[model samples]
Target chain A: MDLPFSTPAGPDARSAFEASVMRHLDAAYGLARWLARNEQDAEDVVQEAVLRAYRFFGGFRGGDARVWLLAIVRNTFYTLRAAAPAPSAHDAFDETLHGGEDGAPDPETLLARAADAERLRAALARLPAEYREVLVLREFEECSYKEIAAITQLKIGTVMSRLARARERLARCLLEPAAEASP
Target chain B: MNCEEARVLLHAYLDDELDAAASLAMAQHLAGCAGCTQRYRGHARLQQALRDPALRVSAPAALRARLAARLPAPQPAARAARRWPALAAALAAALALTVTLATWQTLRPRAPAGDALVAEAVSGHVRALLAEHLLDVPSSDQHTVKPWFDGRLDYAPQVKDLVAEGFPLAGGRLDVLDGRRVAALVYRRHRHVINLYQWPAADGETGTRERDGYRVVQWNEDGMHYLAVSDAAAADLDAFVRAFRGASAAGAEPAR
Candidate 1:
């Protein structure tokens, strides 16, 4: 059964909606940071989301403002991403160059430390934006299969399979480090 | 359940979209397939780890200051609507409030978490039973799965295939437990998913031991702790334990 999500946002509802968005400041910013991959750009996206949310605060149906705010953040991020150059200025760390892990407690003891976080960032920079985009959404955004679907406009199944393959390729990049170290 | 099927259902498995019959099937398969289990756990852990970095960067002072100065004190809905055309929706909502005193709650709807982690395990278990797609990365050769874990994590994880001998290696994945990332190897005998969550120990501490409704053999050795859980007949899981325990003790450390 399809039902409209909007209920009535009375005086109480409006205040509650604002408060609700306030609570999700961290979450919304977190998501923006993941997508933009830079603190500044992420902040820019968050700012845009907040403003848009304020502008349309009236249209908001009174259920789950957090989800609504996040949805807005998702929408706003792509718009900026399309206009923004090199998305890296946003400061999101792509883990490709680090080649995955090394050195923690001790070298061998540290299973998969991002000893190569820097290297990962560089390697990630070299990949096509398509691949980098998926990794950021799946890895950093941690958006659910459905959420990713909504954000990327891809089917849920596509999101999963794409993420799996992307990780596999990323793993390949990371694994080369071991081969380089050996012999 | 075969590896390909498990891969397809991995998302559904995580979302808990399958019904009871199917979930049980996957559980049975993951119980004994090492390859499938590792992929599942790894996907999950990676998802979690990737999000942690975004915890919170305290809105930069510059951004916060800019926001405070530019944004007006949110005008009272009534007053703002008159001054700013942009706040028409806020005005509309306020108007609706006065016209109808009906109580309505909208926003912050609770979610069903049963679809995520624990539910994923059950879904994985069930699908394996109905179909043979339990192992996506099929291999009796520990060499295959062991290598897959090479660049994935620090210590190569042990993925043993003992299904033919009554103790089947289901699959493996990277999982999180005890606040540390670990490997969860799946094994099975009949209709149980034996989740063997393993993580390299910090200083080399074997884990705890206890018998819940299920049989769990958890202990740390060399540098990793293994927690093997199952709903199979206790004795059968014991057989798997004996075989696994023996392998490590006998020095078949394929996970270099």
Candidate 2:
């Protein structure tokens, strides 16, 4: 085997790839977790994506592996969810659930940032699934309209519309509560 | 420009697909129309929000190493492992058609769950012990190790050498720890295997806890954190950790 796919990087590539993955993995995991809604299932999705990325890594066209991984993550979620047992959606185990009235700032980001920071992340965590994926891909993943189209298999226009709607939902989310509180 | 035109152009403008002239027109319209401008601003703010490097989630050390070890393929092995059971079942069924054979042995053997994740890291470390694929970037020097990982990994892992204390720097390898490729700086202390896994910390940022009877230490330094797992005594690990940290601080060659 050419070993193009095996991860043991040149004693050096290993650290680089690990760092890149860690930097991006949580966002990938968070998105996967939100969409899948179970810790084990989300981990399963990430592991599956990691494996797929490994096997066909020879085909990777190199610009920003994070973007590539994010694409794989979305694909992995749908693929695995289709094959696996479905979980009850939005069962609300945690006080700060996705799409709930309020969502927690992912502790990964919130732990280190300023006090006022988690507001947007908390708002983001509250977005409905349909809106969250688009926002995550377009916003955090930095995927182009075309890339989002390919990842979601939607028309470019649909990607655009959904992103605009995602932003609108977030804007509504951010503005509505503050307005209500201003009395 | 009308709402129809602005609506049509909003995406193109946000996506940077518009020509210079059309972009200018969109900007002019965006300046004149508050609602559309807010929409544009919403898109812009949301776009900026996504790019925040802070928003990127760090995969924990355990998860990253786990990912790295299996990066080329984790699930497929499970799929492949599934076949042995079917094969054994077929063999048993054929024997039963003739004269029933003991079906207990038909249960195919598979690697246990915990072993499965640690296989590559342990085996690779052991193999390096045997064959010496250790340390492409050789040097216990933190300066060397840090810069060695500069273009290699996303973050720098702490590297140190405690040769005086008996653990000599054998080498380092880029292996997946928790599925993310990370630095696995190898060391030798009288036959006990040591694997130090370093990757950015993520949502799984719970504190250091003992895993499967192994002494594991995790802590943050500068902007990154590291987790080192070894079957060796905690004192030895701490000595190594102290040496590593001290070396990193002194700007000397870290414990190899």
Candidate 3:
């Protein structure tokens, strides 16, 4: 693919870069928001990501601008998150996150209750970041599996399995009562 | 595809990521097996819930402005070229005149009916922003916003709360569109405010159009016509519409 900005980071190149990639700001922010789970942290991550993207703009071989920008956003989010003082609970692996068929509600009841936005949000928030990122990329941003794999840096097989596990965990969280569900 | 294999492929199938032959095989297995079908339905419901627009967050405008300010100034070469003072001044004059003419052509009321509606919607959006009159009832709760529109207009506008989907129900107010009072529900996506104008459906037009840096997404659902206007990204506006429509379809109860 033709690189839109081959000039030496000149005015024309800067405009070309902004017009091409900055349009995906929402996509970048959305991914960061889901991963960071808050506005302030998400903003910090996106700010850093944009700077990284701008610095690397000259080297960017134009393909899918959204995906490329999103990959950088995801990487930036993780880098900042790692540098933060405390690791969030979302990073921890809790055995309770699994959905067991033990005394599970019927599908109709489960679906009806899960449709509630608050319940769904709380459930999603409880997922480990790895699981949450895949679900967010797939369902919210509507990225294809290939795009998700590209952004997350996971093999296609790993992406598929992680998504499966993520769905099961989310459903489990949704099915259980809120009080017990808070891990 | 056995239940084991079907279970593994179900997510891909629901996501439409499976190739046709694999998808067909999964579908065929699902058709015969009630257990897998029920599982598929459960997973499908979960997927649908995950698509709630409230789940996504747009970049705040403040962030965009901050980033814009931080960007290094470009085009030293362009500045150098400006050494041709007389020629540069002439070019600038020509550019200004061209801009004036373009603005005049757009601002003139020469657009066809459909285009006129789009322009009016855009104007309404800009007017709300400029006048600082975004809402009469500024509440995030849909119950408050929905009832605020009652008896204010001839038709009842379907109000759906999308706080969970990302756009919070900001409030509702009355706005004039096509010289008739319309119900305008306000929703906020980060710093951007989305003004959704609605009234009894007329037989004129329905689609999306861009005007003056804002997007106007017009559509008819049930008995009312809707024109959602926002300076938010075009994709965000489209998602807002989808979430609005989905929330309306899923239930009348506000997504808390």
Candidate 4:
């Protein structure tokens, strides 16, 4: 990728770029951690993403550095995922079942019983990559529908529907003791 | 809005994604309707649960340092080239000539300097480990690791599989030393890491030194300066040096 303008070859410009990118390191790593699903893989993704961002720093037109950096992090994760290995069965989640009309248990009781972080994490992990990504971007990252749309390259309507479906699936996974008891 | 309409927009309502009119309608519906309000509360509870601090993971400290160390230094020449498109071609020719001349000059024989280079090598070794930036192109296979340096550096440093010698090849990375880019070949001896820094040698005799409890072994072979730095005992480092030199020598003859 080419930078629109020449980056001045000096410590000042270098540090400016570093500062802009570094501030979003947590956001980048956090998104990567959720997407990649492990610390080592997350580190690898972040490391590569950071380098790519630096290389393309010349092209960065100043705006929300966090969003800009996270976009690179997202792209890097996809690239690494594609190159690394074939997807396992567990990586795939059925979107049709995400819209199941099963009646949820009482919210208060379910919330109290399933408040454990491990259970929530496991449920989140079981989600299909697409649903999981939208959930994390909205619930975890607190990004708006427009921001999620921009990052994931989905329409705003799709972001809303996916997030709605993702939350429902997560709630089912967390609350349904039968699903947990099986395996 | 009725229950069906409210349910469809419940998530948007919970997320505050609705317009002012829609939001007002939803709020009115939630106040009057028990079921929708309960659903909204459930959504809020789920959001709270997901946002728990325990559920979030922070970037590790070493990872942050590793990324910082990997940031490329500013390339002033590239900026200069961009500003003068006409001069870029001429500048590229001059640069090629300068690199060629410098490579030739470095191949000539001279006594190797002590202290400064040793200190630099030792620091590079420590910085790489402490920052967790040990390898940029991590691989045990020489074939995989060697080709990674192509177009990344001016010269390709030899990557030898030393696993048979108890020092296995880890990977390689482009490092800056003495204000010039050099190839750093990484190898692992048990838990210890050895960084072999190589650049076009400036006619220097082989030497060894110890600083900060690390062994620094320096040698020049086939127009490249090889400095191996590690915390491993000097004897093990020496064995590495010998094995590395022998491997490179064996490979160099075929290329020549």
Candidate 5:
């Protein structure tokens, strides 16, 4: 539980810090890629995240290093997003087109007809950042609600609701093509 | 529970987040309600599809290598400032204790060279433990731990298996002492971790010192300077030195 930053940074301390952070690189990259929506952007975000994590490593209290690292990645991604230009027209379109709607067909029936991986990725890519992050953490990372709450800094109640909404939106998006084709 | 309540709780149910009683209630509701059960099935399928390992990309090897190569070494000035104050105090106390103890016994006066090295060794040992940098290549096998230092340092340090003597080999790490790289072979004695640092020696000599509640035993063998540091009792470290010397003498290999 030694705060790594408070201890004088030495090569040994740096290596230990590196070992803890490196173990979660893939997971961090995965979250970054999903959030940033591209490999190049993800690479940039993760590299920045690594640097930020190292800078503040001395503050890290020992626990689940993966969760700790992903939280940093999340923060770094948001910082980068804030610095970038405003969301594009397509992003705006995605928001308005797929904004949560009530009285949709049952998600089970909608998802049953959804197509393959590419479509799933497109559907996930279209979700708002908040919803996408929760869904990805839960389904892809296999994080429990508590962990998701910690990583996303959301209350457990918010996490559950966002997850529910994310699923609803994803099911709606995935079912769109099927509905169009049959109608 | 009705369909409306079941729908609200379904995600938590899928995630196994609900408490036992609530989970049981949801299970009971799903059993009786075909609609909620199908919705549950759909949620399960969505989770399964999203879990496609392909969706979670592994960080590319190039990026990993880049980050490893690019990570800044600890700033020397900052490191010195942060590491030395506590050590200087410990060394001062050790010097004081040495002076007091000298008048009471005819024990060999503490070697100045050995005293400085022991302080450095103790600092390295404590830093490794506190920072959780006990090992870079964690292993029990001598061969595995020995080869890990290859190409990373100028000389090969001897590694040995001492599990039979209750000091099991924990692992090895490269440490900087006296402004040069030295091999730190780690061993565990019950709950204590002992750091045995080895570098090329200029002369044949042996000594021991105590600093900040830790004992350090130093020796020279086959042109290698060996300094072992730990918070364990002086008697225990003496036994460790004996076992280490015996093992190294029996299995000494040509230094590379």
Candidate 6:
């Protein structure tokens, strides 16, 4: 039987991989948790992503290991979502709407509600995954537009627009209590 | 830039993704525009809320252990290449054989009753500290930490609040040792972290050993095998063991 233990770096590679990638487990889990919106599925996503990263460690030619791992993490999330569709599969919110629409509350209302972490978390959770992921990468993870683009595999323009729309929806969700019932 | 244009570019400008000229233009607009400035503040506030540490949770220690456990063990072939000097084919073959035997001696299964168990318990404790993943449910209250094991483990491990005993309960997590799942309860003694691993006792034996500068104390109580591992001084660990054993004997339950 042929053993597939032919990676050049050997045991040292395992240690090196852990040193580089394991440190980012929290970040990876954070992203997965937000995207998957549950502890169990988020764990599954991280586990699968870590396995894929381990398998492809030989090809990992040095870059931001967090970004590299998160890219894999997000792709794993989408793949899993597709294979076993989530109950809220369709992201119902309109992505095209720019900042202002009719009856949009003033930013001050949002500012007040945003101070409440529970409300902020709920509003972020209510966003379409598309918007939520970008906001998470940009705001929570503190990734650059370029980094967000790289992780999400979208153009920098798309990243900016998605972030804009995400923030708008978050503002709306915070202000209008009625928005909670829509989904 | 007009209000319309400035508002449109607000996110990009705030994100610092704008070019110097556009950023300068946006800043120039915001200086004169109060409405836009408040809007900018709202966005900043929202971002600040998102940055709350409570928003992001540390990955559970069980998940971390699971990932670490799955990584392939180091193969002997790699070791042979590193240490063996290039020599005649016959000499290389002999060296390979020698290396294989040495590897087998190290890798071969032990009785799973002595050094093997201690080694695993020590490794789990060290990994928790090194990875900085000491807790899955980080709470000082034993009530909070104890119930966390429900549905996650087959049996609920007795969680003792050693706070009054000076080793305060930090939290609890699930870990696998000797190919069996065990509950690792975390405690702190000033700066030192103690991981007390417990599962149903296989056979009753109590002992203490020092390995790699970390002290391991093993005991069987109430049909549970407990291994308390930490880098604390031997005397401190012994004190911890006495306090823990004493607390267990007293049937201490802290106010539910």
The whole-model lDDT of each prediction reads 0.52, 0.56, 0.73, 0.72, 0.73, 0.74
DockQ of candidate 4, scored on C-alphas against the true complex (2 decimals): 0.31
lDDT of 1: 0.52
Q: Which of candidates 1 and 2 reaches a greater DockQ? A: 2
Q: Between prediction 1 and prediction 6, which has the larger TM-score? A: 6
DockQ of 5: 0.18
- For DockQ, the strongest prediction is 4
Expressed as tens digits, the lDDT of each residue in A1-183 for candidate 6 is 423222323579788889999899998998999998989879968976886676556567789999999899998888766644234744766556654564434666777787788877877887888888998888768899999989999999888878877887788778867645644
Candidate 6 chain A worst ten-residue window by lDDT:
A1-10
- In the order shown, the candidates' DockQ scores are 0.07, 0.09, 0.20, 0.31, 0.18, 0.25
Candidate 1 residue lDDT tens string, A54-168: 5456566566666677778877777665543344432343434233443111212122533345544544444444455566655554556666666667787677666655555
> TM-score: which candidate is best?
4
The TM-scores, one per candidate, come to 0.44, 0.44, 0.56, 0.61, 0.54, 0.57
What candidate 6 gets wrong by more than 4 Å, as runs, is A1-9, A86-90, A98-107, B75-256
Residues B62-179, model 1: lDDT tens digits: 7555544323343444454465444334334333432221122123243244222233233223222211223434444555656655544556676665755676564554433422
Give a tens-digit lDDT track for model 2, residues B1-256.
Answer: 7866676478679879677998999999988887777556555655566566665554456656766554322232233236433223222222232111111212325546444334334433433332223455666544455566664565667666567767777556665544455777766566465667666665324234453344566655666556666656778777767666665432443334
Off by over 4 Å in 3: A1-8, A94-99, A102-105, B75-256
TM (chain A), candidate 4? 0.88
* Model 2 TM-score, all chains together: 0.44
Candidate order by DockQ, highest to lowest? Answer: 4, 6, 3, 5, 2, 1
> Tens digit of lDDT per residue, candidate 3, span B1-256?
8987777688899988899999999999999998888878888888877777766677899988877754544632244235433223222332233333345444565978888788767655654443234566878877677767665555667888788899988788776666565788888787577889887776547888877666888888777788898878898999999999887621354345
Interface RMSD of each: 14.1, 13.7, 15.7, 9.5, 13.2, 9.1
Question: Which residue pairs overlap in candidate 4's backbone?
Answer: B110-B203
lDDT per residue for candidate 6 within B172-216, as digits (tens), equals 876667655578998877657789998888675579988656689
CA shift at A128, candidate 4, in angstroms?
1.3
Q: How close is candidate 1 to the true structure, as a TM-score?
A: 0.44
Index of the highest-lDDT prediction: 6
